[model samples]
Target: MIREFDRWAYDNRLRAWRAEWKLIVAFVMLAVVMMGGWREQWLVLIGMAYWIVARARVPFSVYGKAMLAASVFLGLSLLTLVVSVSVPFQITFIDSQLQPAAKLAVRSLAAWSCLFFLLITTPAPDLIAVLRRMRLPAALVELCFLMYRFIFLLEQAAAELMLALRARSGGTHWRHGGMLMYQLWMKTWQSYEAFSRSLAARGGVASAGHTHQREKAHVPLVDVAAGIIMALLLGWAWRKG
Candidate 1:
C-alpha cells in the first residue's frame, strides 16, 4: 500500500509540481540566508512547514521526532548560556545570539522536513528526468543519479555485513565492537569502489539518453500563479517584519 501511494506521488504531474515548488522554496530559503535575520528565518520555517505538511503529508510521528531532537539541543544550549552568565558576558549579545540560533534550528528542521517529503514521494528516475529538463549539466545529473542509486546498494551491503558479524556469535560487545565497525567501514569503502568502477565502465551514463526527452519544460499556469503568490507573501513578510 505504501509503495502504491509512493508510485502515484511520483507520477509525472506530481513530480513536476514538486520540482517547481522546491525551486521556489529554495529561493525563499536563499533570501532568508542573505538577510540573516530571525524574521526571515521564521518565514523560511513557515514555508518549509507548509510544504512538508500540506504537500508531503508527513506524519506527526516523524515531525515529533525532529522537534524533540531540536528542542533538546536548543534547551541544552540555552541552559548552558544561562548557567555560564557573567557580568563580562553582555546579556544583550548573548540573548541576540540565542535568538538566531533558535530560529536557525527551526528553519533547519523545516527545510529538512521538506527534503524528506521529496525523498519519500518522488522516485529517483522521475527526479533525474526533472533535473535534466531544468538544464542541469549532464555530468551533474549523472553524478546525482549514481549517488542515489549506489546509496541503497551500499546500505544493503552494510546490512548484510552486520548480519554476518552477528552470526559469528562470538563475544561481541562494546569492547569488541571495533571489529564490527572496521568490517562495516571496509565493506562501505569496497562497495563504493566497485560502484565507481561500474559507473566508469558505463560511461557514467546513469539514465537513458535524453535524445527522446523534451528540450524544455512546459511550466503550467498553476506554477506561475504559485510563484506570484509566494513573491507577494515574501514581500509582505519582509515589510511587516
Candidate 2:
C-alpha cells in the first residue's frame, strides 16, 4: 500500500501541478478540520475524496484500502480513549469520554484524508525538497526521509510475518496476533540495523536530494477557484453553526 501511494504520487493526474499548490490546499483545510465542528469535517472529507479519487484519477479501491488500513489504527487508538482495554477486557466507557472521543475520531479522520491527498499527489523526495525550501531544520528533514523509507521496510516485514503465521496454522488465539507483532518488531529492528551498518560504511547521505530545485509547474485556475469556493462554504458553515 505504501508503494502504491508513492507510485501514484509520481504518476497521478495532479503531478504537473505545483507541489506547493497541493501543500497549501491541504494545510488550509487542516485549519478548517481542526477548528470547525462535525459538519465542516464531513464536508472536507467528501471534498478530499473527490479530489483524490475523481480529479486525481486514483482508483477507488486503492483509496478504500488505505482508509481501511488507517481506520484500524484510528479505531484502536480511539477505543482506548473511551473504553479500558486491559486484561480481562472490560467493555467500560465513561459517559464523558463518548462525546470527546467522537469529536476526536472525526477530526483525526479528516486530517488523515488531507494527508492522503498530499501523499498520493506528491513524491516523498519532492516533499522533502519542499520542506528544505521552507528552511526547515536539516535534522528534522532527514528524520522525515528516514521515516518515509521505513514504511516500506515495515510493510515488507509485516507481509513475511503474516505468511509465516499462516503457515504455522494455529488456533485464532489472541496470543497468535501478539506473537506476529513481536516477531515483526524483531525482524524490522534487524533490518534497520543492517541498513544502518551499510549506510555507515558508504558515508553517503540518505536520498533526500539536498538540491531544492524549483520547477515551472502549472497550477490550474479552475482547481484554485474550486478550492476557494469550498473553503468559503466550509468557513460559512462553521460560523453559522
Candidate 3:
C-alpha cells in the first residue's frame, strides 16, 4: 500500500519539474521555522500538509498513517518530559513541564511532516541521483540504494511468510509468532548472503558508470528560486529570534 503511493509519487507530473535539492532546502527552512515557536511550528506543519495534499496530490489516508506512526513515537518520548520522579520515588505530573512537552511535540510533528512530504513526493532513486550530483561518496550512495531496495524485499518476504503460517495454523500463537520471527530473520540473512555472493561473482560493486544513469528530469528554476527566498527569510527570522 505504501509502495503504491511511492510509485504514484515517482510518476507524478510534478516529478518532471520538482528538483530534489529544492525540496531538501524547503524542508530545512521549514524545520528552522518549527524550532522557533509552537505557533509557528504548527503553521509550518499545516502549510506542508497543504502542499503535500493539494499540490502534490497525495492521499490524506496515506499521509495520516505516516503521521500517526510518528505521532506514536513522539507521544511516548514526550511522556518522559511531562512525568517526573522526585527524591521520594513517586512519579508526579509536572505542570510547568507541559509547556516544553507541547513545544517538543509541535516541533517534532512539523519536522516529521516535512520529511513525510519529501518521501511521498520524491522517489528513493531520484534522491540517490541528487546525492551523486552533489558528489557524495559513491560507496555511500550505493550502500543507501541497496539498503532501500532490501527494506522492501524484506517486508514482502515477511508478509508472505506470515500469511502462509496463518493459512496453515489458523492463526499465530505467541510461540508460533516467535518461531515465525526467527524463520523470517534466518530467511532474510540467507537472501542477503546469496545476494552478496552474486555481487562478488559479478566482480564486486559495480562502478557508478555501470550502475546509475544520469537523471534527465528538468528541475524547475522557479522552485529553486522560491527555495532560496524561503531560506533567506528563515535565516533572518532565526537571527531576530
Candidate number with greatest TM-score:
3
TM-score, candidate number 2 = 0.79
lDDT of 2 by residue, 104-137 (tens): 8888889999999998988877788888779998
**Per-residue lDDT of candidate 1, residues 1-241 (tens digit):** 2333344455434354555555545655665645645565566566555544554555545555655766677677666543445688753445546665666566655555445556544566666877887899988987787676666666677667668777876536775577766877888888778867987998875464432222235556755676577567767777877
Give the candidate number with the greatest lDDT.
2
Off by over 4 Å in 1: 1-18, 33-36, 65-97, 110-121, 170-172, 193-233
Model 3 ranges off by over 4 Å: 84-91, 208-241
lDDT of 3 by residue, 1-241 (tens): 6577667667653566445654764567465655576555655677677667766677788778888989999999999988988898899999999988887888888888877777777777777777878899988988888888888888898888888888899655788788778989999999999988988898885654324334456656755564455556555655665
lDDT of each: 0.60, 0.84, 0.73
> What lDDT does candidate 1 reach at residue 54?
54
- Provide the TM-score for each candidate, comma-separated: 0.62, 0.79, 0.81
Clashing pairs in 1: none
Query: How far does residue 117 in candidate 3 sit from its true spot (Å)?
Result: 1.5
